[model samples]
Target: MLRQYELLERVRAYDPDADEALINRAYVFSMKAHGSQKRASGDPYYSHPIEVAGILTDLRLDDETIATAILHDTIEDTVATPEEVERLFGPNVARLVDGVTKLSKIEAQSENQRAAENLRKFLLAMSGDIRVLLVKLADRLHNMRTLHFIANAEKRRRIARETMDIYAPLAERIGMYEFMTEMQTLAFRELEPDAYQSISKRLEQLHKGGGDLIDRIGRGIRAHLEASGIEAQVQGREKHPYSIWRKMAERHVSFEQLSDVMAFRAIVGTEEDCYRTLGLIHGRWPMVPGRFKDFISTPKRNGYKSLHTSVIHDEQMRIEIQIRTGDMHAQAEHGLAAHWAYKEGKDEAARTQHPWISDLVEILDHAGSAEELLEHTRMAMYQDRIFAFTPKGELIQLPKGASPVDFAYAVHTDLGDQTVGAKVNGRVMPLRTPLDNGDQVEILVSKAQHPQPTWLNFVVTGKAKAKIRRFVKSKEREETIALGRKLFDEIVQRLPVPLGWEAIAEALRRLHLHDDDALMEAIALKRIDDVQVMEALLPGSAGKGQVKPPPQRQAISIKGLTPGVAFTLAECCHPIPGDRIVGLRREGTGIEVHAIGCDRLADGIDADWVDLAWGNESDGGTARLCIVIKNEPGSLAVITSILGNHGANIVSLDQKARDGSFHTFTLGLEVHDVPHLMRILAALRATEVVSTAERI
Candidate 1:
């Protein structure tokens, strides 16, 4: 029932050459493709694509994106095919339609998993060509705007959660701040209607009183700049409700404590004018210390650059002001899209501006399966970034709080493998030091060092983790293959007659294995009995019915332990190798073991405590211990030195502080016996200012 002129208007907005003939062809094709179809709202299905196309046109997308938007749903819900689309339109238009079509089909086992996979697919498509995601986002925006039409509550929640996790983040990543705000606001409204209403009402009241004040402040600032012969446009924009909600949660403060909820933007003609405008603004108002940022000189990782400062007006009202050139404004609004010029055919230059896009596209080239490509896409796209730097001033981009090990891997796998230590801001730090913005990190590497299995715990980047996993898996495969080959050769030597491949294969099948390699590896690991392999290869072998005897059980009992209690292994002493241990009955249940004089036990023990002993047959495992001490330089180095000297491999380490000067650190280590653990504890306690050391 929609008029044809509306569709024509959208096409003509981006394409001046658009005419009635083209619009008519699209209309007839879409009408036939979506014959008698109705949406969940019971509206004619053709109306949805028209609405989606309208949204894209409003965003100033190119002609192909708009056309693709018009036909996006045809292939999924109708009889239309990609081949037919290509025949009707050109390859570019068809590709865009195909991308949008692919995004509509992922099915996961649960709502959360479905949302996650849907996001994964969206990122994959976006990485290939950003316009695909743009069109999809526009579609989602329209759907969210009309979400009330859907009837089911569970379905509504599932869709809302997906929008929150995927679409909203996608909008932010692309620098569509306006779209991001709306999507988040709508999703919040659906997911937590009560919270949304409460926050919305509060924000509405705040805006009513403060709106005119911001306008007055903007006028005053504009008058001053104009009097000084500066040419600029000043406008006041309030923070979105979702952003205010996020700020409240992050700062744990009430809405009244939130300042700078409104900001003034100054748009100028040149980059030099931006800085000059900043100087003029500061002269008019007092600038707040540590509240100024010179992003123009050093842009954000996403390529956002502006001069920002918080200043107090004559009435002592605080406001944030941002100064940037007109070009920067366009970049801020359109993000990577603003850089692409179709007329110039500068694809390479455009890709250079958005390196992450290129990196994501490159993932497709190396990806072997659809699932891997999808995974790589999600990891590359849906991440919040932190900008850190090498000591030499080279920038290294990583996910927020990425450790030095992640940094080393970002530089090169070889560097990560050889990295022995690191320094942040000229002071040595632990390998797990969470990086902050603008940090100058210097990695110390030794030729003999290699990555430990524990490095996986602190790494934040998916690329770094994937690479580490790949390297470790490769090494493990190589080792297992070599072990398998060695065991096979030894077993063949013991055979009286040469075994045929068929006999070996049959023997492997009887053992539930795939090949000789697996059977031999199982033998190497003692998972398969050695005598059984010979029995399978020979007739009437004695090993056929002979089950191996269980190993002798070490007879041991703890005196202070109660029966029928559940116990957990202590991480501090990681009871591995060989060691003497004593059990302490905890108040609740299971026994806690410690190297007899563990400081943790000593502090808790009074006259009522009794001694407990461990059974003789205990094997090596892991244990945890806590150390409290003064925070100082090289503190971690001293601890690791002691543990390393005692031949104990440190498995995990975490540290926190009650105050800046004092820290409590938890360290997990493997030890041979109770005596060795006590010796390490004594060495750690000998360090100055060490208050306590005990098994936890």
Candidate 2:
């Protein structure tokens, strides 16, 4: 544990303007607040906060961030309140401590929910001041470092999994490679003891066998750079066990098959030298094709820059090399920490300008549940990135394997909603086409088009899927409300006396609904039927008119039309089970139902109309298929054979048109829904004698 004065001196050494008195007060206050409490490791609880504070000093964070780290657990595990912390430490430290405190207080029924709630709170705070995430990460790092001290194996593994799934990705997002790597290693050990041990033993054996190999390789790389008039410092080492293990698992390769396990870094003085060093190395050694990347030209979203390549050294050993300037090296290792370290004179507003932060906030608004937020945020955080561009040259960074729909969503939600087609590099492509690095994408959108539920099948980004789901859900709710309102009106008209909104409000409690909207939505969704609503509205009235279905057969029931309203399906368009049909009442003529989009409906027949839908019991309907086939006896037989094989019962068949060698026929068949009709059509189209097949 760091002493009060040592912690203060450490902060002062890096930040001369750090508040000494503030640090001392925080250090003493945390220790006193913890009192006699001890960690699972049997050390004084205060020691944990002190160690976390020490870690923040290594990042060279501001004084408030460091102080917040010291007092993060005060409100969570102790009697100390946020009000008291604010009175003692001022608002800045109090706010950060409050953020961390909220993250700790979220308890849920399941482990997944708990993690999601905690992450939700953390992200909310992170949006305000990224320092909240910084302090929380430091706290998580210290806990991970002492994780083995915890006695329960299951508890330790759960903590390790959460750390791996959430915290480590966050650290990497903020550009803290050092913390990310160490946290991953610690978690990997707890989660996969056997694999971790095997890899650890292999690394140790390699280290012993290749005595001074790292040194010799470093010297040779340095000598080569110097010989080419490039002054660079070369460092080499074996990759981390977790990284090596991941490579083996991903490629399904044995340890012996891994050639580029050893990596070297050449720290140069200038950006120009970084690339020159890359060229010189590639010129000297046989370069591994498709293994080089130049991040110096286009840095990562976190602002990391480097030149990476794999080369064959000594004509046998394949090694990976990275070249970067000194400043780039610091940022690559520390990420956001390095950004803050030298952020003097630069506007503080620049710190919170990360595009992902706003994206997280948007996700919070759009996510429907804690699990959804967790899944979407994880998808957003963890991905190998690829950079695409708009036709206007604006850069759009996306996860590798992302489709154009993902690209459209990244541009704007409206664009994604209205997207109908896409062009990749001036050539029209399918909407599901995966975007490649540096490709220019132009999305073609139309106001008439909205996100299709099928878009969820191929979109890789959470943002696109979230927006699409929200839209689809909203549209469904609107349609459901419309149907429910029509049903409610019809039910009321059948009553002894007409009921109003107050009557429905009175019935809400009996039906276990939240409010009128919920009740109506339920009615629209068919979860609650006309009989149930009438029973709720007028007690014992439902049993009077309810006609129980006969035992042997299931029959379709209409809800919005009164019991004796008498409705007939219009024959002009042949409204089916899946079609949106509406009820039209004419004077003394009961009612006529027509598909909403039917050309017959466009005739503007004047009548009292109500929205209608087929109930869940409505199983089968007839559909008409207009198909073209060769005008031969065997062709008609083949068509009939295909329909019978697909279980379509043909109701009627008529020859609509004929040519020299082909005939057009309109056939009516009983189908379950639009999908059944589509399958039948597809099967007919696949037949050798059929020229075309389409739904009428």
Candidate 3:
């Protein structure tokens, strides 16, 4: 733990105007609040907070941020209150500390839910003040560093996975590459111990074999730059084991296949010098094809700027290099924090430049569940970005595989909802076209246009998905309720007595629905049986103790589905009349009807389930048959003759096996109902050509 005087001196070194008294007081308050507390490592708990504070000092953060870091855990882990912290420190520090504090009151769903909710809260907090994120990142970093001290293996893995999935990516979003790299390294070690150990051992062996290789190359580059009359500082190091392993995984290559494992950086005095350095290096070596990225000219979405390239040196060695000015280097290292002012405490404008924080905050509102929030945010954070521009030259950044719908939403949510078509690079293009970097995109919208369920299949950005989903959900409910009303009138007309307002009101009460609309929706969604609704409207109206199965005239009718909405029978269950059925309703796809109790229904939990019954008037449908017949000459003729005699028409034919003396055929038969299909099976079984017969 950093001593009080030492921590103050470190802060003063960065900003002489830092409030020493405030820092001293926060240190004392945190220390006493955490007195006698111990961590899983059996270290004094105060050490954790102070260590986090020490980390902020390295970033040259302001006094208030450092103090917030020191007291961040006090509110959650100790008896110290936010009000008390505000009294001691100012409101800014107190708010920052509170933002970093984990929410203990979240209902326990699982670790994932808790992590997602916690992520949701801090993302909102970071929208107002980024210092909360900075402190939170530091806190996570320190905890990850000490994670091995925890005894429980499952608990350790959960924390490590959360850090890898959420925190590391978050750190990357802010351009805190060092923090992101360190956290990823630690998390990778815990998550994939064997892979981590193998990569580490390989790297160590390379280090032992190659003495001064990194230094020699770095000095050689600096010498070349000096000879070209350019002043520069060059850095060279092997890539971190995690970075190496990730590249291997992504490229599907082995360690022996990997080249350019070492990277060198040339930090120069000016932007011109940075480019000049790049020219000098490329002029001296054979530049690799398609292995160059000029982020300096077009910076990343996170404001990272650098010119990266890979070159083949004369030794048959492939090496990667990055060139940047000193300012660019600092910006690349510290990311958004580089412009965060520490001396004057005036970085609010810098914080405003990060619109992604607000975008994430907006996602918090529309996400359906905690897991969904995490999924969407991960989709937002963890992807290589493609930059597309509007016809008016406004830039829109989206994930690499983003379609025009994603581009429209990234530009504005309203535009996405109204998008009808798009033109990429002055030519008409499909809406599902994946955007390339620097492409000019024109979104064509009309007032009549609204989001379609089909767009969800192609859209990539989280914002587009959330907006499109909201529109779909709202439209689905409204349309479903309308369909319910139509069904309600049809069912009511069948009753012997008219459904008066009094009867309808009593039906809603008996069905535990809020109103007629709720009851209608329930009936339409198949949550309530039509017979049940009749019984509720008038006791015993559905007949005596038990409701009878649907007779031909009493079969339920399905009608009024939206024009584009399709209803199809599920292939898995081969459902027929007299079998209970339900429809799995997924947006952009048909309502797939499945037999009740089919194993496939379990996987459709994410899809909407609607109870369905056959219409009173209908044509015959197909039922599948599995048959085994002797593979003799004229055996096929006997099967066709038997089918013709039984009045069963083969709709489709698929043979499963033709081994030796037997042929196993899977056939779809046109039939009126289950009993009619059973008769065909009996007829086939009675013949010697058909050794065995059964419904599939």
Candidate 4:
């Protein structure tokens, strides 16, 4: 743990105006509050907060952030209250400390839910003040560093996975490369111990074989840059293990197949020299096609800038190089923390200036669930990025594999909701087309166009996904509620007494529903059947017993006036009177009625099963038949004439494919009942032209 005076000295070295009294008070107060508590590492719990504060001091954060770090765990782990911290150190420190105290109230939830809630709390705090994120990140980093102290294997893996999924990505989002890299390394070490050990062993073997290859490459690059009068600093290293593992997984390649594992950086004095060094380096080597990117002109959303290239070096080694100015290098290394290091009010300035921070705020507004928010926020914060342009030349950055729908959403939520189509490179393209780097896109939208659920399959951006989902949920509920209302009115007519608002209120209470809409939706969805709904509305209205289905041989009433709206008859079985039926409630559309013995009903992927029965109200219904006849003249006539003799009218006829020796006909015949259709089929089967005939 950092001593009080030593911590203050570290803060004052960076910020001479830092409040030494505040730091001292926080340090002493946190130590006293923690008392004799111990960590899983068997160290004093007070030591953890002090170490977290020390980490922040290395970032050169303000004194208030350091104080917040000290008290962050005090409110959660100790008996200290937020009010006490506010009283001692003031509101800024208190607020940040409270924000970083703990993630979420994870009570009795599934593991997935708990993880989502933790991320939800973290993102909410980060949006309020970026320093909350900074402190919490430091706290998590310290916890992750000591995670091995935990005895439970599952517990350790859970913490490691959460850090890998959430914290590391978050750190990267704010331009904190050093923190992100270290967190990822620690998490990777815990999550995949075997891969970690194997990769480490391989790296060690390579290092031993190369004999200071990184230093030699760095020296060679520095020599070349200085010789060209570029005034640059060069550094080289092997790639990160996690990065290498990810590449291996993505490309399905082995370590030996990887050519650009060695990366070098050239830090130049000016922006011009950054590019000059790039040009000079390319001039001396054979450039790798499609391996160059100029982030200097189009910086990342987090404000990172650099020129990247890969080349075949004089040593005949393929290597990756990044060239940037010193200031760019600092920002790339420290990210948003660099803003606080050099200026006053930079904390708030950075929070306002960065699009990503505002996006986190925007995400909070539209998320419907914690799991959803975590998923979309991860998509927004963590991914390899691709850059594209709007029709007017405005640049848009999106995750790799993002579609035009993502581009529209990145521009504006309303634009995404109204997106109909897109034109890529001046040619009309499908909306699901994945955008390419540097592709100029034109989003074709309209006021009449609404978000479609199918877009969710293709859109990869979180903003696009959340907005589309919100719209879809709203639309489905609106339509379902309207359908429920119509069904409610129809059910009310069958009741003994007329219902009023009082009856609805009574039903809502009995069903534990919030309002009439909930009651009606439940009714439409058959969550509460007619008898249950009537009983809730008015006691004993449905009598002592619920309505039961008639015997198997008897046909009950099933009125389907609107085939596509209220329900649809399954064309495969062509159900009629005296045929048992089943109803499947499909998504988006309504239920489909299938014969009980239909082959299509055997598939397991159907929607919710609804009880269905054949109605006696119909005089007759259509039964389709598939007939294979000899390929001779008058075969079609013979089949039609036979059905006509049985008093079965041809509703429709379609010629199917013709095989070598036989032709097929799909015929829809109107019959009085199932028995009548059977009689008609018997006559058709006896014909000379009909080779095989059966009801479809």
Which candidate leads the pack in TM-score? 2
Backbone clashes in each candidate structure, one number apiece?
20, 0, 0, 0
Candidate 3 Cα deviation (angstroms), residue 437: 29
As a whole number from 0 to 100, the lDDT of residue 578 in candidate 1 is: 44
Give the poorly placed runs of model 1, Cα more than 4 Å off.
1-3, 18-24, 40-42, 107-109, 340-696
Q: Judged by TM-score relative to the true structure, which candidate is superior, 2 or 4? A: 2
Which 10-residue span in candidate 2 carries the lowest summed lDDT?
A: 547-556
Residue pairs in candidate 2 whose N, alpha carbon or C atoms collide under 3 angstroms? none
* Candidate 2 C-alpha lDDT tens digits along 1-696: 688888888887878777788888998899999999999989999999999999988988888888899999999888999899999999988988987777666522367454434443455445446667777788888999999999999989988988887788767766788999999999999999999999899888988998888889899999999998999989998998889989999999989898888999999999889878988998989999999998889877666689999999983799999999998898888876765552453446555443333232333233345334333333334335665667544446677788999999999999999999999977999998988755778999999998887788899988998998897677656655655665566666656555666777779989988877788677655576666878899777667555333232222245433222134677777777778787664443434677788877756456655566777646567788899999877999998888888888998999988898999999888887777788888888888899999888
Candidate 1 per-residue C-alpha lDDT over 1-696 given as tens digits, one digit per residue, 9 for 90 to 100: 445687677656555664446456666778789989888889888888878877766665566766787888888888888999898877977888888877776533466345434554455554445677778888898889878889998888888888887777666665666677889989988987877787778768876866677778888888888898888899887776777788889999987888768888999888988888999989888998899999899875455678999998885767899999887887666554554323233234333433434222333223345343333434344345555556544446667779999989988888888889999877899999998755667899999886665678889778778877786665554454444454445555555567675777678767888866677556544465546676676544434343333223222243222222223345444443344555454332334555554566665463123233454544445557889877888777887888888898888889855667778988777776667788988998998856789876
Clashing pairs in 3: none
Q: Stretches of candidate 2 above 4 Å error?
A: 107-112, 115-118, 342-696
lDDT of 3 by residue, 14-93 (tens): 78888888888988998899999999999899999899989888888888888888898889878999899998898988
For model 2 the TM-score comes to 0.57
lDDT of 4 by residue, 1-696 (tens): 678888888987878888788888888898899999999989888999999999999889888888888888888777888888889889878877766764533322468554434554455445446777788788889989899999999988988988887778767877889899989988999999999888888888989999998899889888887888878788899988988888888999998888778999999889999888988899888899999999989987676899999999877789999999988998898887765563554344433333443233333333344344333433334335665666544446677799999999998888888899999877999998998755777899999998887889999988888998887767666665665676566566667677776888888899999988887667656777777887887788788543233232222235533343345678778888778887775544556778888899877274655556655565567888899999998888887778777888887889898898899889888888888888887887888888888987
lDDT of each: 0.68, 0.77, 0.77, 0.77
TM-scores for every candidate against the unseen true structure: 0.54, 0.57, 0.55, 0.55
Q: The CA-based lDDT of model 4 is what?
A: 0.77
